[model samples]
Target: MTQPSGDPAATGVPTCYRHPDRETWIRCQRCDRPICPDCMRDAAVGFHCPQCVQEANRSSRQNRAVYGGERSADPRLTSYVLIAINALVWLGVLATGWKNSDLIARLALVPKGTCESLSSDGYYPTALGERLCTLGTQGDGHWVPGVADGAVWQLITSQFLHVEVWHIAGNMLALWMLGPQLENVLGRTRFLALYLLSGLAGSVAVLWLSGAGQLTLGASGAIYGLFGAYAVIAHKVRADLRSIATLVAVNLFITFAVPNISWQGHLGGIAGGALVAAVLAYAPRARRTQVQALGLGGFLLVLVALVALRVAALS
Candidate 1:
């Protein structure tokens, strides 16, 4: 009998279906329901009611990009910032620490902790006058003394520190080349985690496998992590991974071929990076955050256990 109020039969002006108290001629472009200004939301082409917006989103297939992030986001921003920090660190090294052994000793990763015997030797100090290098020791030994000597923080700090001009340049160049693509695919936050965690895992490998008193520092471990990330992500999407694989192979060859490079660090980093990429690329979308947290936490615990076990064995 009533052609519905919205048909303009009952009243001259259409009434809002949601807010019956408010009268308006506006109708949702999708559902054709009368909506008030309070219920209006901007849509791409025209206004939509809240219900229509939600329903549209629900019905949407949520077409995911191969890399797992929203297609709309830009991953380059974080990569650029990360590259800048690394470059700044290198600049600081050049300004005050290019030849400063003390600064290098203070920051570089040293496996040995402070002890009466000085444990082992064959390590060279980046700084000559530092107490860590000059301190009296038993047998053939070199000691690097610092307030933070043998501290756990060295694992993190050591990644950003480099010994020579070509060293930082080489590492930073690789970072610049590989960083943006992976960052875009993984998103900024996950990419940062992969880089740091991969580097840490590399350091942990050094701690586990390197001889005592070896001083190892570089961003190579982290860069290697990125390499692993790209490879793993590609594999997940069923995309070609051979290009990254070849790069990894060449780098690994160089790692072992070079005298000072740490193959232990490289191998550790690759393994860590691959595992982390698995966590990021393969996680279920519904529980991605929770799954990532659990995976990372588990790996961290493994590192702590390895460190404690190694320390206890030596002590």
Candidate 2:
């Protein structure tokens, strides 16, 4: 910046353009305009005049990502927030205890909750507003005493309700590892939508493939979705998928080999995530947003179809 000459009386003191009364020897680092201390704002390189600062800010914002997030903002912020929410939810569920609690029964998405059931063996206290079942009570189950009134919200809520610390920890670890890259590439809104939809799809899978009397809950479905998303993103960038495929294969093997794990949910979540990623990664830029919305909506409709079919099969 050009410094004000010391001969103030000869040429008058160089003053702030915005505050002419105040004399100053400083100039804006950006615009080189002489500014008083009050009008000056600290900047990366040096001080800036208020006008220059405003202009720079406007320009910076204009260069932000399509979703209005700064490119330089922490890419992991969305993932961190998701982890925090899941942790808090786990804490709440733990506080309530895993067994015989209305809180958990309300959250776990069970297919039987969506329809009339013959028995309530797998359900919580239905009298407490939980319309319960899941994979168990569809046709042959007994009306258990404690099942709650059934709710459709469980399909989504169940994804966030992990009763075990290891379960949530595993899921969060996977998220922390994979979420930031996708968030940075897809932006926050899209990443969140992908996550939620994938998880819901997983639940829907369980509803369709598992016995209506079976019970399931956790974030595994959503995390599986991220795995699929990471693969698709790699493909989009022309990166090799051998490693991602291997990781997915191992998880799939674990899903099938493990007892008490929701394999149906995991598989369904992966399929859902890959489908969504296909839409996001390959859509034409000219109408990308519209295509993405339609693709996701179509996926959701497919899930609804799956749920409806399950209900009919049991009905």
Candidate 3:
């Protein structure tokens, strides 16, 4: 059958499908439908209709970061969230009697459980056995469980716990500075993984190196891990290293020279961060994401193994 023909004057040579009342000779490059200027969207080859353009955009692969993670739209958002969490926890500690807070007893990383005097906020000597301390309840002291005694949450909680104003302030400042940078590079998920794992590494160090009764708490380990990750990323991209090297040196000096600083945590964090960053930076492009995931899993297993060994020894 012959196709019906319309008058050219009534509907210019080829009318836009979206605006049949109007006239347009231009056709959509994608769908081959007549389109007016209002409906046309620029494309590599020619114009596309709004619907076709939307469909194409919907089907296109999402942008990815250098190391295969999805690109983050708001890098600073994650950093702000982390800072808020740390600040809020510090406030809780502040409200609960600062250094004497029972919250600290529950959250702070202690390799082995200890007996604490609730009245004086002091720990009883280990020579006084846990059995003896268990009997002396009200006035004497109470048993405070540690990682060995199944307070496993302490490994993570201790990183967020801070008793001193200056301590929290310093760590928050460091986080605000470093967090966004890493997030932008690694994207939110990988960056968060690097951070939490680094903190765990620091806590593990404290568990093994520091005295059993030594109360270790703070984000310094995580902060140190950020520093280590930054250095690794910078080196990978061939950025100047002198500045970061100097900063790390200065921080190391402070870690060792300071009276009450936990050097073990800081060093352990650095090692963990560097290791994670290395995996992120060096993973082969063909299977970048898979390699990164496997490397990180291996690292986590190592940390878990170390913890198991330490717990066995302490037990």
Question: Of the candidates shown, which would achieve the greatest TM-score relative to the real structure?
Answer: 3
Q: For residues 38-142, could you state the per-residue lDDT of candidate 2 as single tens digits?
A: 887998878988887788778774545443333536779989998988888888876775554446656776666433232443334342212334344454333
The model with the greatest lDDT is 3
Query: How accurate locally is residue 106 in candidate 1, as Cα lDDT from 0 to 100?
Result: 61
Per-candidate local distance difference test: 0.75, 0.76, 0.87
Of 1 and 2, the candidate ranking higher by lDDT: 2
- After TM-score superposition, the amount by which residue 63's alpha carbon in candidate 3 deviates from its true location, in angstroms, is 3.5
- Residue lDDT tens for model 3, 172-202: 9989998998998898899999999999999
Instruction: Sort by TM-score, best first.
Output: 3, 1, 2
Q: Summarize candidate 1's per-residue lDDT along 17-36 as a digit string, tens digits.
A: 88777779888999999899
Alpha-carbon runs more than 4 Å astray in model 2: 1-72, 113-150
Candidate 1 local distance difference test against the native: 0.75
TM-scores, all candidates, are 0.75, 0.69, 0.83
